[model samples]
Target chain A: MYRYLLHRILQIAITMFLLIAMVFILFRVMPGDPASMVLDPKMPPEAKALMKKQLGLDEPIYSQFIIYMKNLLHGDLGRSFYYGRPVYDVIMERLPNTILLFTSATIISWGLGYALGKRIAWRRGTRFEHALTFMGLLFYSVFLPWFGLIMIWIFSYRLGLFPLGGMITPELWTAGGAGIIALVLDVLHHLALPLFVLTLLSFAGAMLLMRSSMLETLREDYILTARAKGLSEKVVRDKHAARNALLPMVTALALSLSFSMSGGVLTETVFSWPGLGKEIVSATLNYDYPLAQAAFIFLAAIVLMANLVADIIYAYLDPRIRY
Target chain B: MSFFEIQGLRMHYATSRGRVKAIRGVDLKMDKGQALGLAGESGCGKTSLGLSILRLLPNNAHITRGRILFHGEDLLRKSEEEMRRIRWKYISMVFQSAMNALNPVYRVGDQIVEAILAHEDITKDEAKERVSELFSLVGLDPGRAGQYPHEYSGGMRQRAVIAMALACHPELLIADEPTTALDVIHQKQIIEKMDELREKLGMTMIYITHDIAIISETCDVMAVMYGGKIVESSKVRDLLRRPMHPYTQGLIRSIPPLHDSVGRLTSIEGEPPSLLSPPRGCSFNPRCAYSRDICRTSEPPLRQLNGGLVACHFAEEIPWP
Candidate 1:
């Protein structure tokens, strides 16, 4: 087991290196100059050249890559041109909010999808299954931004059950020791709309996948053997059928986890969620090459880390699967 | 009273195309220490009859008519809960493809123990001990029970399945082609083990298979099925020496001889009739070389002949080997 884990860790490291190199090259090849974005428009050509030299922008691409790699090895992620701060520091500040949103969305979708999927599969050829299937297809087919808007209008505008947008209410941030509690509650209240939108769109695929897997697993001869052994219906379904059925779902979850770091770009931007998706979009629009590069690297690291975690979980779930 | 009796059994599957008659009306009885072999081709409803005894047919399939009595109690009339209580304890089944029948994720020992624990109120340790005893009974090394199903060879897996079937000391065991996937040597070993176990436990058995040679060796009474109905039944030796039904005669002739001058083996001419819309009179008329006008105009009832039951309009008239 230790050897397998070590092998996986080494593979993840190599994958991260390749991802960084690819993003670095792609960012450089894009037709944009970070120095120009940062410099004063009124400055003379010689001053601009001096600023570019200071930023190491005048060096050849290979030399710049080597310097970047050396600094990255020493725990330097370069500086953000717009923020005028270390890229790591800016990312760290935004990391918690993204983690909070992504983690909650994942848990909610998985829990809801699995439970509902199993229920629908068990009660197959029923009204509830038909309704859930139709609703799922409709929700996922629509654009994410449109779904988010519809949810906000229904739940926030008409019902007034949740805050419109943003992390915390203005009043809660200044409310004393109770301020932390109020802030947490406010954030949760603000989170409801986006969470529901994301979950509604993403959960359908999980539900459909889990339902199909469960149906297939139920047909396996082992499950019939279990039943013939006089096991209770619940025990047969939960212990025998569900565990085997979840194997395919485990792989699906792994792939979903890796890609979920990019949230729904339009949804994040529409809600001003301040996640990596929003950061990358605005950086690209402003031609902030350094900020865009940092965001891409962070996103790549997240996806790679998710896949590594998934591999570990896969090994635990099924011993037959190993590195 | 017999250990179990299946009287007038019938099952049909409702498919999109039409109703498929899986098992036509049939009657079978097994005494406490008797072994019965149900022999037939693939679509002859032998497996369906076995499953109907346990009420384990798929959703589309139903026991349209039957009276399965176990220890004088009607199994078909019993509640699902009552049937559940009787399944592993009173009657157990060793399905075909033992390798796929056992759960792959569980250890072999744990699976056997689980079978025991499900029916009996025993502690885990007691269940483990019983599992080991069962392992030894089936000619497996008790210590190897800790291994997973994948770790065992094909023969060993079938032995494990037999061990599991015997876990609850069931009064009757149903084996559906238990050795169908094994080599000839392993098949002999399994058949011998089953015979020995049957003698030791004094348990009745209903062995379902298509191999006439195997049934002749292991079963005391044999029934031949075709197109969802039994065409012939008798003592194994009697059936082999004098098959009264034309279909049964053809089946017996189809078997290649151990030493023969015939260059090629005899075979039945055509496939079994479709159960959806079987022939108007005899389902085997199209395939029987000796079929006559009476055989094609009226269905034959199972009637007593010289020494066995034969379902043929001209049972006494057909020539036999």
Candidate 2:
């Protein structure tokens, strides 16, 4: 097991290196002059040259790459020309918010998707199954931002039940620890709209996939053998059917985790929620190359880590898998 | 009264296309301490018969007609709750492919103890003792009971399954091709162990298998099935010496002899008729060499012969070796 883990870690290191290299090259090759974007066009040429030299944008592409790699080795991700702050500091400050939002959404969607998928599989050909299938398809077909907007319209505008945007209300910010609780509650209150929209959009495909997988697993001879042993229906379903069915879902979850982080950009922007998605978008629009590069690296790391974790979980769940 | 008797038992499966008659009207009785073998080729419904006896058919299938009496109680009329109480307590089954029959995550001993604890109000320690006893009863090392199913060899896994079946000391044990997945040597050993256990425990058994030779060796009375009906049933030795039904005769002739340089073994001419739209007469008539006009027009009823039942129109006319 230790050897397998070591091998996986080594492979992840190589992958992360390639990912960083690719992102760095792509950002450089893009049609944008970071130096000109940072400095005002009306500024004197001499002042612009000094600013370009200071940011190391005046160096040759190859030399710039070497300097970037050296700084990356020392854990220096460079400073953001747009924010006038260290790229690492900005990312670190924003990491918790994105993690909190995406983590909750991931857990909720996976849990609901698995439970609903199993129910659909069990009660196949029933009205409830048909309704859920249709609803899932309908929800997923709409764009994420549009879905978020619809949810906001229904819950925030018409019903006036939830906060329309942002994490917390002004009153909650000034109230102390009770203030913090109120703040969290307010955040969660506002969180419901976006969370629900994201879950509805992402959960359908997983539910469909899980339902098919479970149906296939149910038809396996082993499951029939379990039933013939006089095991209760619940036992047969949970222990025999669910365990085997969850195998493919584990792989799906890993791939989805990576894609989900990147895919939340539009939803985060619509909600105006301070997350990596919004951060990356604003950085790209402003041509903040360092900030954008840092965000890309962070997203890549998350995806790579999610995949690695999935591999480990897969090996644990099924002894057939190793490294 | 017989320990277990199935009267007028019938089962049909509802498929997307139409209803398929899986088990035609059938009757069987097993006394205590006797092993009755239900023998047939694949899809002949021997396994279904075994499962129906336990009320364990899949959702698509239902027992349309029958009374299954276990110890004078009507099993077919019992509620699901009552059936759950009876299952693993009085009646248990060892399924085919015993290797996969067990849960891979659980230890073999715990699985047996689960079967025991589900039926009886016993402490964990007592259950553990019983599990070890069961393991030893099936000729497995008691020390290896803690190991998971994957840890054991295929033969050992089968022994573990047999151990689980015997945990509650069930009166009626149905083994559905118990050794079908094992190597020849393991198959022989498993069959021998089953025969020994049956004698030691004095339990009635319904052994389902496609191999007539294996059934002949282990069963007291053997029934040959075609399509979904039992075409012939008699003492194993008598049926082997004098198979009455043409299908049975064909089955016996198909068994390749180990010593003789036999020419290509005889095979039934055509596939078994589809149960969805079975032939009007005997289901085996299409493949029977002695099939005649009556064989095509009228279904043969299971009739009493000298010492057993034969479902054939020309049972008396067919000459034997």
Candidate 3:
């Protein structure tokens, strides 16, 4: 197991380095000049040239790559072009909101999807199973942006059960007009629609996958063995069959959490929720190479970590898996 | 009332082709401490009959007509809820494929403990004790029970399965070809272990196997089933010395003699008849060397012969084993 861990950590380190190099090279080769974008249009040619050199844009691609790596190793992610703040700081500010918003939605959907999926598989031939299967697939395949828009139109605009858009009331927030409790409540109120939209978007895939996995598990010989053990139907389902059937669901949770570092990008943008996804969008439009690459590097770490966590989870879920 | 009995049991499977009659009008009865050996080649309904007693047949299969009476209670008339209570607590099965019978994720001891906890109002500590006892009884070290199924060898896995079957100390244990997957040494060890347990616990056992050698070692009474029907049944000693049915005679002859390694030892001539659209008369008629015109036209009933039961038109004519 120690050997396996060492191998996996080595793989992760190599992968992260390659990713940083690739992102650095790709951003450099892109058509837009970061210096021109960051500086004023009225600046003198020599001043412009000085700004380019200051930003290290005047260096060759290979030299720039080495500088980026050296700076990255020392915990410097450079500065954002548009904001003139450290790229790390800009992302750090939005990280909590993104995590808070999407994590809750993802977890709730995953849990319910897993539980409901097992039931759907067990009662496969029944009408309730079929109805749930159809609805889950339909919701799962619904385009995320379109679904978010519809949720806003109906729940926020038509029904008035939720706030229309934005993370919080910015005016009140900026002035510190509301108490801490009131601010928290206002944030939750704003969170409801986007949370609902994000939950609805990811729910179906988990459910459908669990349902199919459970159906296969039901046919396993251990299920019959459990039945022969005189286990009640409920115990047999939950303890014997569903426990084993849940392997894929666990994998889904780990992978989704890891790979979706930029989760609900369009949803965050549509709801104007001030998440990293929305921040990345603005950073992209403004040609903030440092911010974009910082976000990309963060996502790379998440994906690599998620892959490791997935392996560990697989070992936990199935005793057959060792390292 | 008999300890356990199955009367007029017909188990049929619905395939894409049609309904296949796996067990057609079979009858078997066992006393409280009696062990019945159900010997047959593959597809002779031995496994089907074993599963029918527990009402654990697959989704596509059902008992067409049957009465499984345990202690005079008609199991066929029992609701599914009642059957669930009867299972494991009263009668448990050691399935054919022991290697896959255990849940791969759980420790072997946990699976056994779970079975004990299911029917008994016992604490986890008590359950763990029972699991260890079962493991020890099956010749496995109790500490090894913490290991997963894959960690155990195939034979050890089969032993663990046997331990799990005996967890609740069921009155009746149905072992469907339990030793078929093991090596000869392991087979002997398992049989010896089970025999010791049966003597200690007095549980009724139904031993299913194709190998006649296994039957003599494990079972007291023997029933030879072919084409989903028991053609002959008697004390194992009696049947071995004098097999009245021609099919039984052929079966006994097929076992390779310990000393004589001569030209290919005799084997039952043809393959087992397909359950789907089975032959009209005796399903074994196509393969039976002694099959007569009457044997080809009519299904002979199991009738009493000299101190034993035989289902053959000319049991008296087939002189000796």
CA-lDDT, candidates in order: 0.84, 0.84, 0.87
Report the C-alpha displacement of residue B127, candidate 3, in angstroms.
Answer: 3.3
Across residues B88-133, which tens digit of lDDT does each residue of candidate 3 receive?
9999999998779999989999988888887899999999998888
TM-score of chain A of 3: 0.96
lDDT of 1 at A191: 87
User: Which CAPRI quality tier does the interface of model 3 achieve?
Assistant: high
After superposition, candidate 3 runs with Cα above 4 Å error: A175-177, B259-264, B318-321
Error at B232, model 2, angstroms: 0.8
Model 2 alpha-carbon miss at residue B10, Å? 2.0
Q: Residues A1-323, candidate 2, lDDT per residue (tens digit)?
A: 78877887898889888888898888888787787678899999999999899988889988988888899889999999898999999988776667667767777788888888887987788999999989988987988777788888899989998778776676667765674566678778878877877887878888888899999987776676566556677877887788878899998888777766663777777888887778898888777878998889878887878888888898788755555
Q: Give the least accurate 10-residue stretch of model 1 chain A, judged by summed lDDT.
A: A171-180
Instruction: Please report, as a residue range, the 10-residue window in candidate 2 chain A with the lowest summed lDDT.
Output: A221-230
Best-matching candidate per lDDT: 3
Q: How accurate is candidate 2 locally (lDDT)?
A: 0.84
Model 1, runs deviating above 4 Å = A1-14, B259-264
